[model samples]
Target: MDDLVRIHDILQHATPESLVILNEIFTSTTLADAIDLGGKILGRITAMGLVCVCVTFVDELASLNQATVSMVSTVDENDPAKRTFKVIRKPADGLAYAMVLARKYRLTHDQLKERIIP
Candidate 1:
């Protein structure tokens, strides 16, 4: 995969002073695969002592190791569709990707059945 190739490059060349930023990666794969592979990449980055900023939808990634510091975007409780746009520095929890994203995008069960296009 393209991501794997890029990751290989990073692992081979990145130094401690480097700042690595990764967006949602391995998205074409399953949740378990995404977490497993992404977590390994994070592990390598931490081992190299690189100052990395990894933004991911995987909640489990929030607590990979001691070097990882997670920040999560919050949604309004009263209006779940409204993003507070406030990021809190904490480990993400109870966000099982599928259900969380469905709710976040306002794709309720009824709404999904009514949709024609993504």
Candidate 2:
């Protein structure tokens, strides 16, 4: 499809000095196919030592921990209406964003339990 063609075009002329930026690629395909194909393309780019900034909802891709890969996400501490994006040099925590934020605000289940018991 168009997505594939666009990606192919980008890859065809990509070089190590390239700074590729992609957003939700292969969305026209199934989730699994998108992840698989996208991962392969990204892997190829990574192998070429290209600097890429890809925005995707696929956790598999976001969790990529290669030496050439650095993951960053927008974080809104406890407010959902605003985007207080903090630039982090690592992957997001394994816990859900809400849960992590709750912990930050001392609002986690464990924190509540301690308050109730003590």
Candidate 3:
């Protein structure tokens, strides 16, 4: 996502979904701790070899209703790798946060760092 043009286009067309995205990303066990210890959950995911990383872009979710967004890398059962999701506090457009925990997975520190890098 380093390409500004692509990033801009994503921002333009991106519409965040409701917080349910978070539910789909992490299991009920992990979801219980997502909001309280978001950092820890993220760390655990990375330790598990997943790529649920945080991003720092202009978030439109906030504009919808003081909502906050968190980026994640969830595992896809149907696929071999993980998928990214934008976790939002409130529901908005048709887009929902990416579910990185849809499947079992983990990510190393280097991989986590790469995803966080701007």
Q: List model 1 lDDT by residue over 1-118, tens digit each.
A: 9999998998788876788989988899999999999999998888888998888888878899888898988887876656788989977875534666687777879777778556
Q: For each candidate, give its TM-score against the true structure.
A: 0.79, 0.67, 0.18
TM-score of 1: 0.79
lDDT string, candidate 3, 59-96, tens digits: 33223221233443343447535453534343234333
Ranking by lDDT: 1, 2, 3
Candidate with best TM-score: 1
Candidate ranking (TM-score, best to worst): 1, 2, 3
Cα misplacement distance, residue 113 of candidate 3 (Å): 46
Off by over 4 Å in 3: 1-36, 53-118
lDDT against true structure, model 2 = 0.76
lDDT of 1 at 18: 84
* Selected candidate, larger lDDT, 1 vs 2: 1
Q: Positional deviation of 88 in candidate 3, in angstroms?
A: 17
Instruction: Give per-candidate clash totals.
Output: 0, 0, 16
